[model samples]
Target: MRRETDRTMDFLDEYRLRPDPADPRLSVAVTGVNEAGEPVETRVTVERALTLFLNSREIVTMMTIGDHPEYLALGYLLNQNMLRPETPVTGIDYDDDLGVVVVRTEAETDFEEKLRKRTQTSGCAQGTIFGDLMDVIENARLPATPLRTSWLYALTHKINQTPSLYLESGAIHGCVLAREDRPLVYMEDVGRHNAVDKIAGYMQHHAIDPADKIFYTTGRLTSEMVIKTVRMGIPVLVSRSGFTAWGVELARKAGLTLIGRARGKRFVALAGAGRLIFDQDLAYVPDEGARHRRKGARAAEDAE
Candidate 1:
């Protein structure tokens, strides 16, 4: 049986998912003076769909460019902090007739109640609030190890070079989960939130450790994004874009090392500097006057 992530591979995989052996249309234009800059036109067929579902009897729908629906569903729950060991995820089934996903969980609970209790905050593009999961972030902890800048750069480059289904279709977002700088899971969706949820779902299903790894995204570091990373207990969060003020503040409070504008060999540290290590063999001089005064005072006090 294929997992949700596997079902998503129609876009992620090089193989075609359309049984009819067809390709989505592409757009082109002739803008040149026979090859010089002139008037041109192009056309392309893009894929889009409304994914609907009944959770606790409320109809929830997400608009997405078709790719990785299973992982999207699973990742949605995990990233939203709705997954529990005993919350039976009966099955995720697709209904072609209804054009929706049928998610069967173990028991029926007050889902709307759970959702309302969460705080409402916005993020880059389309995003939702996380009303009830703040405590989870505050209590979460990661290892006290130093993260080298080399590995951070390697991870950013890997994200840039990843094979994305969205780039092919020109309309989806991507999210990746990594361990010690190597990507272990990658996903894409029309919705950035959905892509994140899929990665979170994959981690939950596999029982992966959040403390030993990082989460990378093409999305900006919004408060909602911070909440998701915090929920996972992951120590580091990096993105190719920028961060909002609140996101950085929450990251600092949670002791998470947030990296933004991470590309090539440069990155901005928004919080938790203690977790990062400067390159070895780099030389720096201590402030002699200040150091001497402090050390001398300590030595004289100890002698007394």
Candidate 2:
């Protein structure tokens, strides 16, 4: 346990970007009563509205934790099909006082019609997808990257141990962009979709190759999550939560390796099982410590 804890600390130190649970702006202290009517003081996630603009056109307003506004703006546009990968970005402007962000691109864009056709997703804080996003992944082919069980175990251990808003406050979601066992960027938000978009924007801005990366989330594997992962060209998507039927179907269709219910030594792969390599010996793996178990893991334990 001590060796694993040391390795987890080392992995966190190597992260290019990770959540700061100590940030005062991300969460606030609240006084509440427990089930036994005992007074308790705890932190709660803060949500703010961020208005996004594509050049001169106002795109949409989102409720976010407000850490990476520029990334959220760019990613939301890209995932919504308003911004293409090949499109050149001139600049991204953010006015924190006004709670607004504008993304300037070299080529002009008009999405007035696409905005009229929007699909509400099953993500927290209400996720919206514009236009026909399904068409974007019809011909998508993800790289057949192999994922080792050892790497999976290492990643889950490190991620769960790393301090974040979700661990500090109970009502937030998190997403991580990782390569093998190393987590690169860890983002947290009130909504799972926003967390994913932030990671997408980071990749686009940093020019990180997604073909060799994996995406991990602290939310259910829904269709929206599967779609966004496929659109990002990532081959592997993992979660500590369970899966939705449509999410599994989409993963199979896109050939994305979808692994969920990943707590401790246990995990379920409903799609793209061909890429998983069972290289770890189960005897050496330890069950997730009760203190470190997230809400999903706890709920699953209750059901069992």
- In terms of TM-score, which candidate is strongest? 2
Residue 71 in model 2: lDDT: 88
Worst window of 10 by summed lDDT in candidate 2: 1-10
Error of 2 at 245 (Å): 1.0
lDDT of each: 0.62, 0.86
Residue pairs with backbone atoms closer than 3 Å in model 2 (clashes): none
RMSD of 1: 12.4
Error of 1 at 186 (Å): 1.7
What is the C-alpha lDDT profile of model 1 across 139-241, one tens digit per residue? 7675555677767766656555554454343445567776655666776655667667777766666556576777888777988888888876778888866
Model 1 — TM-score against the truth? 0.73
- Misplaced by over 4 Å in model 1 are 1-47, 52-56, 117-120, 166-171, 280-304
